[model samples]
Target chain A: MWDYTDKVKELYTNPKNVGKIDDADVVAEVGSIVCGDALKLYLKIDDNDIITDAKFETFGCGSAIASSSALTEMIVGKNVKEVEKITNQDIVKYLGGLPEEKMHCSVMGHEALEKALKQLKGEKVEDHVDEEGEIICHCFGVTDDLIRRVIRENNLKTVEDITNYTKAGGACGSCIPKLEDILEEEAAKPASDKKKEETKKPLTNIRRMQLVEETITNVIRPILQEDRGDIELVDIDGKNVYVALRGSCSNCMVSNVTLKNLVEAKLREYVENDIVVHEIK
Target chain B: MERVVYLDNNATTMVAPEVVDAMLPYLSGKYGNPSSIHSFGGDVGADIAQAREKIARFVGADHDYEIVITGSGTESDNLAILGSIAYYKDKRHIITSRVEHPAVISLCKKLERDGYRITYVPVDAKGNLDLAYLKESVDDDTAIVSIMYANNETGVIFPVEEIGEFLKEKGIPFHVDAVQAAGKIPIDVNKINCRLLTISGHKFHAPKGIGALYVRRGTRLRPVLYGGHQEKGRRPGTENVAGIIGMAKAAELAMEHLANIDEMKRLRDKLEEGLLSAFKNASLNGDKEKRVPNTSNIGFEFIEGEAILLYLDAKGIAASSGSACSSGSLEPSHVLRAMGVPFTSAHGSIRFSLSRYTTEEEIDYTLKTMPEIVNRLLTISPYWDNEKQEGKPINL
Candidate 1:
């Protein structure tokens, strides 16, 4: 059985605002029955852009209902900005916590709130428009972009983690290969600009030589030699990788930028955190 | 607090008082090893033999030696499937249904990865196995056909007797998982004429962790576990004496209560009929006529099952669901999915199973209280279309 908090049990047993509003200022529907949870959030806002009342109609499990009810209670009497700042985590906090499997219910609550907030702003609800990415999971209608965004934001590394966060590939599991591909692409990220600044490892003489040779073969030389620009490993001392530009690179005018931008940046991905490539005349 | 109405017997059963009484001696005082040579220990082997004979007779097997006791139904299943496949090395095919329990289904999946061709015979929308497909799929190299006597989720009994006869004619070994069917209905290995049948003790009023496998006297099976001479080298370990004794007593009580199965069936029908009458947009999952006497898998549209289950739990009622919300996954039970149940209702499916101990008062209280819960939930359901007077089925 799920270890539900007493607050969740209380709110679930007697949800604050249920049923759709008659003449609401904004109505936002998120999710569908196919995904096993759907929440339609109804909002009644004042002239000053303050939410006077919030009601919800949901077709889902206990956590989903609890989350929608909790979302309604949290957003009522709060201004638009404050309501917008309330995230899925905020809703979960209101209910103490939800089971890890039921976290998607809170996410559904957040989606409904965001949609209602957008409608209140007189903006398009962004439903029925697959502008971000094509739907990969046909069962739940989850898009690749949604899956990618969840993976990036949560730093999720596996398809299972993606399902746990976004409900993507959780149903039918036919899109698992696509999810795997996206996970592989995300995990295969190259070293960033920030990483190229610092070289933390103190290198021994033999280790420095290994780093110099490895960088030349694996990183620095591959791209340069492809463009008829050859680089030879000269020596390494401390964080500096000394190299000689050969072939077309010898006469290249932009070799200075190339050495700093491509060579140094690429080498930092593999060899060390900080390694400056200096051309030896 | 109201009395706890247990309708989850398919999950596990309460141990009968008599079974406990029969097992106490073996559990405490009679702790001698059954394999020992001394008189004190050798006497325990006679008790083990007596229990085995009782279980063997309960399943209507001719000889008691054909029964091999094991830890649980899953162990018995593994022993039957893997053991037969090992004994028949030249054969490289397995046939089972799509709705078998995970114990059978997952093993078939592993066998597929090991380069053995496996045919998962599909079922109809009512969860009936496609026997023609099973016949067509069987070939000369088909190693074994493993089909359950009754599905755990739906309680739809398959025609295992008919299935066994045809498979035997094709010169193939057949194994029946009678774990769910043993105490609920009559099972005769001779009538089914299958080479192997597996049964769990806990499905009836027995303690958990004991099961039995019926292997025809001449059937060859390579043992999955190897240690000592217990279970005639088929299952080589010190036997669970207390558990086996409890199972034997459960089997005997099951025979005594066989005449009262009709009464349990009547109570089950009352619950099914009452729930159906009280709720709108609800439907039964499996075939109504072809199911066991005590299980009703129902789907209540527009509300998630876990939500209903939690409410029921609050009211001192016990039931279970294979719905997506009940399971951690977004898809419901594979049994429901394979039956082509639409996603709108499949997410709210519930399985209510009754046993011999159920009373009419409990059923009456459930029938009275459940409608209120359903009505309460429907008021807040977004899919409850008031104008149309029914919960609207969401277009997937």
Candidate 2:
């Protein structure tokens, strides 16, 4: 059984705002029965751009029902602009939390809400097809655009994470290498670039040391250790972070390239753009 | 908590009271290494031998020595498939059904990865095995043929006896995974002409952690585990003495209860009939006549199974589903998919397996409560239409 939160259980047991709005302004359906979940959303909007009412009809699991119920509760009596800003994370937070495997339930709610709003704005609403790219995960009919968007929104790294968030590589698993390529491509971009741009500053010596150590431990070590190697944060001086490669990494032929490319690139992405990683050899 | 009407017996049955009582002595005073030379342990070996004899008799095996007890049904399957493949030595091909339980299917998949050719014979729309395909797939390099006696999801019985006869004529090794069928239905290793068969204890009211593999005499089989001389070194680990005793007692009780099979079938048919008649779109998932008497897999169109299960659970009812959401997987049951079950109903499939302990009161309660659950879900189901009393067609 899934480790569902009490709130999720409660909502699933007695979901609110169920059924379709007969005379609603716009209706949108997302997901599919074959995909194991779908939601049809109904909305009644007032002339003042306020949501007079919101309701949903969901066909999925307990979390899916809870998410649809939570979505309707969160959207009713709110302005269209506010409802538009409600991400799947907001619905998850509303219900305390859902099991990671059921995160796609919340994503289904968010997608239905997005589709409803888009339909209300007179935009083309295709149920399964995405405007961004072709389908990638054929088993679940998840498109590349949907996969990439979920990856970016959820900050998903591994194929398992993508499966939990979007159900892209969860079945058959033939698209896992493609999922890995997508992860690598997405990881190349700086995480939260806007925040990085806003927080550009000269750091104190202690803070620089802390950031370098954190980066090495969190990011660099796992990669090196995957290859039966290790790295230790020996010292940090201004923009130059000194690291000691251990085990197989120490005797590696391309240790210099690894230090300059992988370790330095991570330190720069996490600590500072000018941060450099130096081997202690 | 309210009384739980557990219909998920196919997943695991409640340990029989008699079985538990039979095992308590082994857990307490009889806890001795069966391998020891002294009477303290030597007597325990005698009890284990008696248990094996009972189990062998229950499954209609010719000799007690043919039964190699293992950790679980999965281990028996692994030992059977891998052991037979090892015996073949040069043969690198295997034949299995598409609707097999993971114990056999996953092993076949791994063998495929190791450069072994695997033929996953398809099933018909009624969940019947494609026997002609199986016959055509067999060739000189076919190491073994592994197929389940009864599908776990649909309770559909394959033509194992026929397949067994054909393979017997061709001088090929055949393994039947009888985990779901052993106690529910009668199993005769000689009748099926199979070289190996697997049975789990837990499915027949025995405690978990014990299973057995029937290796026919003179079958060239290799041992999967290497260690102490237990089960003639076929499975070398220390015996699960308590579990073996429980299973023996359970099997004896099952033999006694075999006459009551028709009673279990009556309750199953009543539940299946009540549910199908109550819902317009509901239908059975497999061949109704050619299935194990204890199981009924019903599908309610236009709704997902997990949602229906949660509703059933709210009313203190327990059952199993073929929906992907139920298993934390993104695809519906492979058995259902292989049977060509439409997407409209595949996600909504639910299986109710009955045991001898099931009562008419529990079945009636489920029959009464299920309509309310299905109607409630229908109101919140996007494809369900209240006025039309039918599901809306969508491009799934």
Candidate 3:
């Protein structure tokens, strides 16, 4: 189960505008039986291209259902042109906020509304396709450039955090390794820049360990400690130092990078030359 | 600790004091391997035989000697399905349902790679097996028909008895994974006439790491795991003495309490009704009539199941979801999918499985807390904007 917000739960428990209108002017549906979610949007369009009434029937999670209901509610008296402009982000922001994984559910609502609007206008809406120029995750239809931009902008440290920004690994989850590759590629640039700053002066191995321990105790421990986690320096050998992580960090998948980038980079910044931090298994 | 409100009975139940007392002597003073040729071993073997007879009597099996003890429910399922398929190597066809537990489903998938043809039967919207389809699919070449007695997700009981009779008439071997239904419902292998049945000890309040498979007399089942001749050459391994004794005692207790099962059913119904009445647009999954007495799958239209479970956990309540596993995968349950449930509502489904131990107070507390939680989550939902659009007053 995705950790839904209070708003998502409300719409799920007592969804509004369910069922269908018999005399609906335009009806639109999206998704398929295999996707595990489907939505049917019914609209009552007036002579002036205004939506007099709107209702929806959704077959999806709370987020999808709520998003559809929210989309219909948002567009019920608005013009067809206005409904076409409503994006998934607008639906999510309207719902207070949705969990990152469920952001796709909101996208479904936006698509359903747009399709309904196109039907009402008697216009041919192009099928949703990843045009040649679009940088999609390929595995899940998320764009690679969008994911990269999110990582660079948010200073995202983990792949899970990148999911919150771009929803790259939420569907099918085949794009996860690719997402990691992007995170690593983006994370390497800053690391090398910091290493360049430390290369100006070289110190001894003992001084490096002391400096790394200080940074961890001051900077890293406080943040991880909030999650009932901690980092410890195990052994310092030549330029390689081993650290044993405890609490939540021990079971966390991304701790390896935390040891490498955050711990090692900070050590290299203030301490000796070519210090490598290794995680104790 | 007031028994700690053991809602995790679905995982395992507390050992009955009587069952513990019955096994004390064998665990300590009478400790001996049942396989030895000495007096000490003979005494332990007698105790084992007595426990097996007690288990056989509870399930109404034809022969007590046919019951073979194994390491767990997974082991029992593996031994029954894989062992049977291997024994009948000439027959390559096997039939099973899509909603079966992983124990049966994964094994069937593995067997499919080994030159076996498998037909995965689909279920109705209420999780009931289509017996008409089953009859049409079964042929002379079909080696086995494996279906679960009841689904662990929705507690929807299958028509195993009917399937058993149909398969028996055709001389095709039938196997029922009765891990969830055993002790909770009445199972008569004689009436069902199934060639094999699997039951997990932990499911019925016995200790974990022990289960049994009922192989009818003269059934050809090759051993999957080979080492010792403990279970009449059918399953080779040392007996789990304590677990088997505990299982026997749990079965005896289940039989004694069979008449009072309606109490649990009533509590489950009360919880379901309360939730439905308190929240609008809420609906139940699976066939209401064919479901187990103590389980209910409810879909709250706009909330995610994980959010509800987390809130419930904070309030000291425990429940499960069929939509996604704990690993955070977004795949809706295969059981719900086979039933043709739409994905929109599938992710919002929460399963509340009750046991005989559930109390009216617990139900009352749940009823009171649920509506409030639902309202809180819905207040900020973009879905609720529909109410505002219709000029309806927002409650929150």
Question: Could you give the candidate ranking by DockQ, starting with the highest?
Answer: 2, 1, 3
**Most TM-score-accurate candidate:** 2
Worst 10 residues of 1 chain B by lDDT: B387-396
The segments of candidate 2 whose C-alpha lies over 4 angstroms from its true place after superposition are A191-202, A207-281
Once fitted onto the true fold, the runs of candidate 1 whose alpha carbons sit more than 4 angstroms away are A126-131, A184-281, B386-388
Backbone clash pairs for candidate 2 read none
Q: Which stretches of candidate 3 lie over 4 Å from their true place?
A: A1-141, A146-239, A244-257, A267-276, B1-8, B113-115, B139-141, B325-327, B385-396
Compare the candidates by lDDT and give the number of the best one.
2
Query: For residues B1-396, what per-residue lDDT tens digits would candidate 1 score against the true structure?
Result: 667899999999999999999999987889989989997889998998999999999999999999999999999999999999999999999999999999999999999999999999999999999999999999989989999999998999999989989987777899999999988998899999899999999999999999999999899899999899989999998889999989999999998888889999999999999998878678999989998898999999888888889889989999999778777877889999899998778888989999999999989988988987888788889999766768765656
**RMSD list, candidates in order:** 12.1, 7.8, 9.6
Worst 10-residue stretch by lDDT in candidate 3 chain B?
B387-396
For A1-281, candidate 1 gives per-residue lDDT tens digits of 87788888998899999987799999988888877888888899898888998999988888888999999999899899888887665676678767767877887888788777777778765674222578888877777876776565444667787776668888778899999998888766645544544446466768766866876787778877776779887877778888889887786544654676567767766666467778898
Q: Model 2 misses residue A15 by how many Å?
A: 0.8
Model 2 Cα shift for residue A128 (angstroms) = 3.4
Better of 1 and 3 by DockQ: 1
Ranking by lDDT: 2, 1, 3
**TM-score, cand. 2:** 0.89
RMSD of 1: 12.1
- Report the number of the highest-DockQ candidate: 2
